[model samples]
Target: MLKEDLKTVNEVSKLTGISVRTLHYYDEIGLLLPAELTESGYRLYDKGNLLKLEQILFLKEMGFELKQIKVILEDPHYDMQKALRKQREILRLKSERLHAIMALIDEKLEGDEYMNFKAFDMKEIERAQEEFKEEVEERWGQTDAYKESAHRTSRYKKEDWQNIMESMNDIFKALACHIGEDVSCKEVQDLIEAWRAHITKYFYECTPEILSGLGDMYVMDERFTNNINQYGEGLAQFMDDAIKYYCLNRL
Candidate 1:
């Protein structure tokens, strides 16, 4: 490890503030492997390996599972810069949420009579949702469903959008409460049917094919998954499975 561009595993651990044991575990799991091993069997990481490690850490911080991160990083067409930009946007949204919560806390401390600490402003949440929608459109705008959704939503007023978001959140909360129910059960199916109708009413006519694709996105897209899982643990995957069942059996 005489090379200036190479770092020993211990040095990398110290520099990254990650425990050596964890790094070893990552290596063992094939998530991150050392660039080389010295004659004395010391693990070494080069500059490229360090950059990959940075990406792994960033994704981990963003709540991605280790296996998911590995799949994303190993994809042949993975866009590093795009991923970083998305991560930055996620951090920005989190910062905004934290700021809003802190402001409510401060208002409570100051005895402000108007303070509503029990809930967040739906407007802010809707704004973040709109931003994410725009991002999705930018990435998938060539698809017919994306174009249809954009056209359908083009005339919606702010208040209309707010109502739509509120309705969606309500549905999510209801579904979260029924998490343990079978996806094909009548109650869950009714809720999912209503969800489908809601999407068609607000965005576009969501056909079974389009709805199925959205279900896959719910599980595959981190931003969407995070939003859904906010209602409850495993809620995103649950929603995905329900959507798939609805599309297959009910459609």
Candidate 2:
């Protein structure tokens, strides 16, 4: 029947890069079940199932609840095109945030143009800061560290933050070089200590746990990993492991 051209659970797992457990959970929750089951009880999915999975992944990444996601997916009136358009808008916001970060780096490389006679049409930096602060707060809740980071724009001059950003970038470059060679060396350890000291200056009451947590986030979160690994491959994972090791040893 439906199993004629469908793939087995193991085959689907390999093809989709989704774990077997997650697939089973989705089936149990009636989120994205296989199209058919063979006599031996092997789950089999068809091409249509793959399309549904793509939709499921898209909605999940956008932070939709499973119940809401199922309703939306099942609704014949639900327009995938419209949903994608909304996702584009969300991506635009994320792109603006990345642009702001790049602008800070650019300001470090190039002289400040704001002080010149040329007038700009908008306050891009302030807009970016507000949007970023709101998004981070909404997602992670307002932690003391995040609050401190938000108020940073007011406390320190733009030039100062630019300098810090450049310094941090340079440090990551150094770390990436070490990772390419050997991560468990004494040199890497010393550099990590310096990095820790640098971080402690801005973040309030920085602890080993917090530092290590950020390192893990660096690799786990695509944005952070992409930024850090711009210089080298696997650098983000190297940093995570190094930081975790340092935290366990030092703390």
Candidate 3:
């Protein structure tokens, strides 16, 4: 019995540019299955199945995990209009993040020529944080760390900045002597405390969670990783471990 909306698996694959194996897998997973099977056991998709497949591919391209998408699509209360609006909102957020990253890249390329580029020091960090306080407040809401950071930063001095850089280098030198030793040792912990004290001058109000996140950023951010690595080979990893240990236990 021929159906008006029916398409054989081969025809559907050709039309959608999806492989036959993938279609079979989707059928096996119950993500998308054919409405009918022929006398020869050939899979045949209907118009509704094709539409569902199209929606799945669209969601996939938009970064939706398969399980989340399945829940979204299968929900009795699912509204296509609402789903599209949510997707648009998320894409907007991604666009804004991308723009900010591009601006940072441009600042790096321009270096000293950047109009608002402040030298990376305790004073500049304080000033910049103050400038962005409203935005940060909006994101994190009222928190002790945020309030404390604002208070701590107001007292940051130029001499403090120079001491921080010196102390950081001194700590790195000490750690280099015992490269493979436990980073959580008392000696390393003290060095981390000194480093943390310096950071507190700029970002005193940050929570333990935020501190840990910054430790991850030290290695994840290529620019920061490069700076530490330039001190010595494997220095970046060592510094990452030290920071992680500090944030985990002592920060």
Query: What lDDT score belongs to each candidate, Candidate 1 first?
Result: 0.72, 0.65, 0.60
Candidate 1, clashing residue pairs?
Answer: none
In order of listing, the candidates' clash counts read 0, 0, 1
What's the C-alpha lDDT at position 80 in model 2? 56
> lDDT tens digits, residues 139-239, model 2?
43445554554444235543564466567777878887886656668888877887888776753456776677678667665544654665578888988
What is the TM-score of candidate 1? 0.45
lDDT for each residue of candidate 3 in 115-139, tens digit (9 for 90 to 100): 5432222443334334333332343
Candidate 3 global lDDT: 0.60
What is candidate 2's CA lDDT for residue 197? 80
Which stretches of candidate 3 lie above 4 Å from their native place?
1-137, 140-143, 205-207, 246-251
Model 2 scores worst on lDDT over the 10 consecutive residues at: 115-124
Model 2 local distance difference test score: 0.65
TM-score of each: 0.45, 0.44, 0.39
